[model samples]
Target chain A: MTATAFAFAPGDIVRVKDDWPERRGPAHIRTPYYVRGVQGQIVRHLGDFPNPEDLAFGRPAEPRPLYHVRFKKGVIWAEDRADDALLVEIFGHWLEKP
Target chain B: MNILDTPSDRLLAAVRDLLAQKGIATTAEIQERIAITDRASPGQGARMVAKAWVDPAYRARLLDDGAKAAEELGIPMRGMPPLGVLENTPDTHNLVVCTLCSCYPRGVLGYPPFWYKSAAFRARAVRDPRGMLAEEWKTVIPDDIRLTVVDSTADYRWMVLPMRPDGTDGWSEEQLAAIVREGDMIGVTVPTIG
Candidate 1:
């Protein structure tokens, strides 16, 4: 399969190898609010989940690769955190090999 | 009046009634959900972040027509009228604060973080976004990057879509989705590469 054809299945965690120069902050749709800026341990992965961007266009595809990312509450929430354990789900590309 | 439930209050009641009927959640659970769901339209701007991630073309469209674009994305932008997605570029970082009230994009994301609505955050986010972010979220934005603090209120709602991270190549959409966090989407957090 071509690069575009590479399927992102839920429950699988992979790394983002390139930087999108035009990206906004860590956006939320499939990603968790707490996982931003915190290195994630991929706990879930998926294949071809409907692109959230597509869902916004009223066209969400089948469930794609969704990963339950675990982050140290201290990492994501930092000083404001009340605990050390906070796990959240994010899509696959949001990760990079730690 | 506290005697009469607000729209969200009524919605919470309905949710409680449904939960009670289903025997899944307790009265406490219902109350928790209601309490957490105080923000009227947190999801409004989340739709833009979600959309921008999927379709580059659509992302462009969202910048042009945030409201109509949300409708196109199957997100109900009803009570929350206009939601805008502020792109966080390399040179600029965007932060959101509700100086007036806890106005946010509930229609798109779901709810506001308890701290986002706090008086302390409101005061600091406006007067000193860099300091507030560093002290609260632990995100130290470089001084070179322009920081724009947007107000979240009944009149206007805003969300930030931080620049996509580096090192994602030919990854599936789900893979891309993995790093997107609600805070990052709101400019409060940045996706970290592990």
Candidate 2:
């Protein structure tokens, strides 16, 4: 498939879809389990690229928008690390409006 | 020497044999790739850091597009993942980790350090980055300073543009580059002037 417009812009708060095991079936997923269902702000849209999940299987892949999402450490860990943050590169399909 | 003593050694040999048997890639080609990878080291990244410290234009370009900036310095970044550089400041510090695997800027930093690939590092980098840095590298990130841990878990690879150490003023770019160690670029340690 051809490249399309980005879904999320920088500063947009989005949530990761927690469907890796049930729907994705674990085929070279880049979204870490820890960030599943976590909300983060989009730092930047890193343009569209072929989905590595599909490319790993030698299948025809379509370009997907990728964004650098920043999550607070407190959101992912039990510790109250409000000053710490994690920047994750997540594809558009794995993200949704929170 | 036992070539296949370890699982990784055995796997490498088996894959090489299969590739050669199928004429997919020759053994010499594989060795050439290894040579290319080995030639890449933290020194390449240190040069970029040093140049950015002195040249504002270069620094802006480096922040805009790390791969292109690396190419400006004659580093061949073609065919490698897009390089993302996280700039460090007095108020904020940056660290790079691949929670999934050891995803790193191999084109610029050669290879990820052994500790960087450890399970403990991956698990704690995002959990307790400030604590981990103080414990392992003895580099403390003050509570007032924000710590940002980047997970290079996808298409783009990441490296830290560490803040230039104080008291290095009036130093040449090459001289400044000498003090920028591998750990500094990895964000495990900071570059110090001695």
Candidate 3:
């Protein structure tokens, strides 16, 4: 089956899908735990590429749009001391409008 | 010390031998791939940045399409991951990290540093980027400027285009390239004129 496609522009706020429980099994996962379920803004569209989550299991990779999402210091760390942003590349399927 | 004697190394050796025995891939082909990775260095990335500094049109193209722009400069980018060039301006700074793995622009910047692959860096880079930069890299971002940390997690790898250092007007591209270190391109530090 083909991969589900979604359009996301820069500056759109998105929350990463919290799939920690489902993804606990043995598989190469790329999403970091800190940013899961956190809200961030889309920095850029990194183009469509094969999903690594599926590719890790020796399955045919379904192409998905990867994005660079920027999270503010306050959103990520509870005690915000730095005035900078953190950006992470998240697949389209793992992001939702927040 | 022979570092390639571990269990993982043995597994890789077995896999390579199996592939060769099955005629799927030759040992020579495997060595060629290893050579490609070893030959790539930060100098390649510095040259691209120097060229961009001297040429505005080239800079535009480099930001627009990093892989194509690199190929135009005779940098072999075929069979490599897509490259994204992040430009650092006066009001903004860019930092790169691979939280999941050491995903880097190996074709342009060679191998990543040892610290880059560490779990500490992966966790702290996104958690406390400014603190990590200050304490680990000795890079202090001014309070006014916005710092953006990029995670190279997927198929697209990234590199930073640092701002041209002052007091280097009319300097040759080669001279500019001389001061552009790997740390500068990774946004761990900025380039300086001597």
Can you tell me the CAPRI class of model 1? incorrect
Off by over 4 Å in 1: A1-98, B1-51
Candidate 1 per-residue lDDT over residues B1-194, each given as its tens digit: 67365688887788788888899888976566565445435344444564576689988987665666777867656545466667888877777766656777665677777887788987766555677789888999885666655544323356677776777666566566666777886788886667
| Candidate 2 stretches greater than 4 Å from native | A1-6, A22-26, B1-32
Q: In candidate 1 chain A, where is summed lDDT lowest over 10 consecutive residues?
A: A80-89
Better of 1 and 3 by lDDT: 3
The numbered model that scores best in DockQ is 2
lDDT of 2 by residue, A9-33 (tens): 8899999997765364648888999
TM for chain B in all models? 0.73, 0.86, 0.89
DockQ, each predicted model: 0.02, 0.82, 0.76
Error of 3 at A95 (Å): 1.0
lDDT agreement with native, every candidate: 0.59, 0.89, 0.86
Q: What is the lDDT of candidate 1?
A: 0.59
Instruction: Locate the minimum summed-lDDT window of 10 residues in model 3 chain B.
Output: B1-10
